[model samples]
Target: MNILVLCTGNSARSILLESILNRFGEGRVTAWSAGSKPAGQVHPQSLRLLQAKGFDTSAARSKSWDEFEGPQAPVMDAVITVCGSAASEPCPIWPGAPVRAHWGVEDPAAADEADWDVAFETAYAQLKRRADAFLALDFETLDADKLRDRMNLIGQD
Candidate 1:
């Protein structure tokens, strides 16, 4: 399965979730992340946390959602919004009719520099919890509607 995580900035929460999903999904799922309005670079604290957790940080970047709207783009099975703004805004039409869900999380990037680590840690924990729940689902047996419903419940985690 292919999943896309989105946020307004794409610097922290979305990036964190993307890394979490890719690492935890093993070979079963491929994950990508982008923003409605990118910050142009991944947040420094986000990079540090991901690296500290032994995740590959090289591919982490802040990018626009437009990159996934092209003909050759990977067709996402699901698209999850991790912030309120991206969830509320009218999103671009992704190539495939990806099931959409909102996993609203507080923006760690919006926190003060001195509090960055704590904020990032909190966001990481929440995202990891939700992603873990998602990975536990029986995708092979679940239909799209059932998967969507389960995804919504996972978002609430």
Candidate 2:
């Protein structure tokens, strides 16, 4: 599945979830992340945590959600919003009418610098749990409606 994860800053939660899904989803999924208002760089702690966890950091970036728009863009199967601000704002209608879900996470970037390690780890754990649940489904066999339902249920996790 092609998944797009979104957040307000795209520096922490969305980036974490995108990395988690892509890493653990194996060949079953391709995931990218963007923000409604990007912070222009990946949060340092986010990169640090991903590195400590042995995930590739080469392709990680904080980008605008607009990058997903247009005829040449990849058609997404799902779009997940990972922070309350992003979830509450109006999102552009992505191509392919992708199934949407809100799996809100507290923004780790908001924490004090000293607490970033713990904050980022906590957010990562929640996102990983939800992504794992979603990837566990026999998604290829499920119809769009069923997939959407499962995604919503997984978001609640």
Candidate 3:
């Protein structure tokens, strides 16, 4: 399945979700990420966190959702929003009308300078937890109806 994870900036949360999904989705799912208003570059701390976790940060980038709306764009099976802004924003008309879900998470980039590392870490942990739950799903054992039902319930917290 091809999945698209979205957020407002595509720099932190969406990037994190894309990395985790790529690593843990086990070839059964191909993941991509984009933002409504991209930051134009991946956040430095997000890159560091992915690198520290042994994920390749090389391909990480902040890109606009417009990239996925063209005729050449890949058909998505699911489009999950990892931030509140993107989740609630009006979305582009995705091909195949991909299943949509909201896994809203705190935006580390929005944090004040009190303790930036802790804020990033908190966001990373939450994204990791959601990714693990998403990867653990037994899709092979369930029909499409059942699978969609289960995926919708993930990351409710």
Candidate 4:
């Protein structure tokens, strides 16, 4: 399955969840992250935490959602929004009619620099639990409606 994670900035929660899904999906899924209004760069603390967790940060860039719209874009099976603003804003109409879910997390990037470590860690842990719940489902077998319902439930975890 192909999953797209969205956020207002694409620098923190969305980036983290994209990495988590790809790492934990174990070849079952491909994930990408984008923002409605990108910061144009990944957050430094996000990169630090991911690198500490042994993730390859070479291809991790904050990008616009426009990159995934229209022809030639990868057809997403799911589009997840990881912040309240991104979840509530209008999203691009993806080619594949991906199931949409809101997995809102407090933006660690909003925290003071000194508090970034704990803030990002808290967001990461919450998102990891939600991602794990989604990964635990037999999603490939379920129909889109069933998959969406389950995904929404996972978002609340």
Give the number of the best model, judged by TM-score: 4
Kindly report which residue stretches of model 4 are placed more than 4 angstroms away from their true locations once superposed: 85-96
lDDT of 1 by residue, 1-157 (tens): 9999887778998899999999999878899999888999999999999999999899788999989887798888888888844236444334355477778888888789999989999999999999999998887578888888888898886
lDDT by residue for model 3 (5-118), tens: 988778988898898889988898889999888999998888988899899988889999899887899888788887754235443333454377777777888777666688
Model 2 weakest lDDT span, ten residues long = 86-95
TM-score against native, each model:
0.91, 0.91, 0.86, 0.92
User: Between the candidate structures 2 and 3, which one is better when assessed by lDDT?
Assistant: 2
lDDT of 4 at 10: 91
Q: Deviation in angstroms for 113 in model 2?
A: 1.2
> How do the residues 45-150 of candidate 2 rate in per-residue lDDT, one tens digit apiece?
9999999999999999999988998888888888888875433554433445558887877788888999999999999999989988988899989988888889
Q: What C-alpha lDDT values do all the predictions have? A: 0.85, 0.86, 0.80, 0.88
lDDT value for model 3: 0.80
Ranking of all predicted structures according to lDDT, beginning with the best and ending with the worst: 4, 2, 1, 3
- The alpha-carbon RMSD values of the candidates against the true structure, listed in the order shown, are 2.4, 2.2, 2.7, 2.3
In model 1, where do residues sit more than 4 Å from their true spots? Answer: 85-96
